[model samples]
Target: MTCSATTRVALWATLLACLLNSGCTGTRYIPSQGQLASPTPPPQALKGFDGNARVELNLPGGYASPDDRAYPTQRANEDIQNWFADSGDDLTVAVRNENIKDSGWLSMLPYILTLGILPTWLTTEGETVMEVKSGDEVLFQNREPVAYRSALSMLLPSAYLLGSPGTGQYQVMADDQLNRHKQALQQYIQSQQKDYETAVSAGTVQAYRQYLQDNPESFFRMETLRRLSELAPATHALPFHRDNVALDNAYIVYLPDEYDIWFLGPQDMKVYDVLRLSREEDETLLASRIRAANQPYKVFNGDEIALLKEGGLSPGLIAAMIDASANPTSVKPAAVAPTVTSATSGAASPGTPSPAEVTAQPGMADIAAQCAKRYAAMKACDQVPSFGANVCRSQVKKKYSHIACELIQ
Candidate 1:
């Protein structure tokens, strides 16, 4: 069928517009020109935790579960708190809301004229005061400014993208603000690490106290406490126990300063065995082992459990491991004790390659190399005398923790 002259002209114009605007297809933030009317405050160095941090998020009206979203307050609270949940309660994080203005369709004329090739934004602007407190003392408080804009174009499916349109405008703004807050927390935690290591090097009771005082939510608190006890025994006191203490203190157990592994030692064959079991999603054998607690391994600590969890172990298995630790059985020494050495540290050592450090076989070589390289970096970071070696190792392992080599084995 032949088109009319007017139709043909329109078709050519449409194709030209698509080509011209191809660079701006996705729903993304428009680059800010000049300065924002209200600049967001940079995230400050404060007390925070990594994977094992116990955080209690407090919204304006108080705690709200993600599962219970019946009310507007609960729904909004859940949107902000969903990503921040972890294991510890070193600090109480409160998010106070402010006025949020929804700027709908900045300009309609351009979009109409360009036949949806030119995009328009649906924006949500707001500010939130994120206050972190250790007991009654406010450790770090900052204003997190939220300016989220979703680009709408016929070529861009905004609804399918994160922070997209079609949701309640307020919810979109809250989610973006929360994400920014999460990033800030990460930066804040890293900044605090340098000071923590400095305090560790000082190796005095006062230094440890200062670190604990400054970073109420530090992942190194348990380590600091142990040091403090060794330096000044009388001052050591029991910390308040929570429901998930095993999960909370897992960081400490998994990455001890001494690279000691008693079971299947000098080689982390047993460690790889657990990783393999997790990959197979079998927790029954683990439960059976937990029940028969005469196994010649040291009771799994919180950090060990955390490592297992990172390596893909199930929660039930972790719980069983925790129980075995809590209720110990008199372990008879193995008839022929396994060698205990640095070989099980999960990093390659000279002379012999640890089982865990062996290069992946065939097709899986690339991932194994990446994993081994990352673990080596973490080990190097831990070797720095003043650094929180355990903390560094834990954080690094969290990123590339899965035992990829276990797949081939």
Candidate 2:
């Protein structure tokens, strides 16, 4: 029975539509380069049930089948470019090499999975499959989903091994993997050691000192001590003991070769000459010593004091000085008298008041004024008058001394 021409045309059109619809409904093979067409039935509209209705969790669409895995092959390349753009020159070069070797794909997959673009899959007996919802939509089934796993695995791991082929580069690609593992272990050890040293260096002074003391055999400790001596010469005398014996009013003098001399008790009449020499001839060294001595007292002024404070001086030293000053006895006259002790000069006369005494006398305005005049005259002389003589010759000095004597001077 042959159909009429008009009926035959209508029947052929209906059959064509059915065929097209069926093709869209089922999966179709497409080459990697082929463009994908929109799926039939599109996606189903999600439904909500009443509070009491048994709720079944629906796995996201792409996660169901391995074939449906949406590996972001294109986006991965974009990310690599972005990474290189933001990185330093060295890192950029490293990334380029890694990409060339296909290692970039391996490293990127983990990241894509985190972004929800790649679905997780399990492999059993060398076959990889994706989890999918069953027909009833109530249960999940592990089915072999379509994906490019073999290609990705081969490309990524191969690339990774290429750029950093193990500890010693070998011709065999398999050996390169082993070398990388060894190199990684060594790098981790070095990093840990560096962290340990950094932590030790950042600790408190006492802690650092203890470390040095305990590690005296270490070369590093010796180097540290040498540096400390060069920077803070006076630190050698620290941790002073009572038996260390105070120098009375002695001043410290620096010698030619980084050596120091302690001139004991400048206040004593016998050492008065040495004190004078230290003050006038060794002014620089004397100043340094005075500064060091006064450091313990906190109120002493000098460049070292400024530096020590700036470098975080111990609070203990400042507090101790304060405590000492609180006691009246702590403040005493310097041991050495101010006298001219040059080799060309004779000894000072007996009972002569010292220059410092003249300055310290109470109500000594007239004495100070007279002394200032004498100072001018003496300064004009070939040799300046002895400090004791200047004080004794001035009437202003007598008046002030008398006043001081009366008031517990």
TM-score per candidate, chains pooled: 0.30, 0.15
lDDT of 1 by residue, 341-381 (tens): 22222223344432222212221222332343344445454
Model 1 earns a TM-score of 0.30
**Candidate 2: minimum summed lDDT over ten consecutive residues — where?**
42-51
- Which regions of candidate 1 are displaced past 4 Å? 1-91, 99-124, 133-137, 148-165, 168-176, 202-223, 231-409
Compose the digit string of candidate 2's lDDT tens values, residues 193-309: 464366457554444445444543231332233223333335433322111112100011101111111111222211223234454554554434443332112122354344334
Runs with alpha carbons beyond 4 Å of true place in candidate 2: 1-99, 102-297, 300-409
Compared with the true structure, all predictions reach lDDT values of 0.43, 0.26
What are the per-model C-alpha RMSD values against the true structure? Answer: 18.2, 29.6
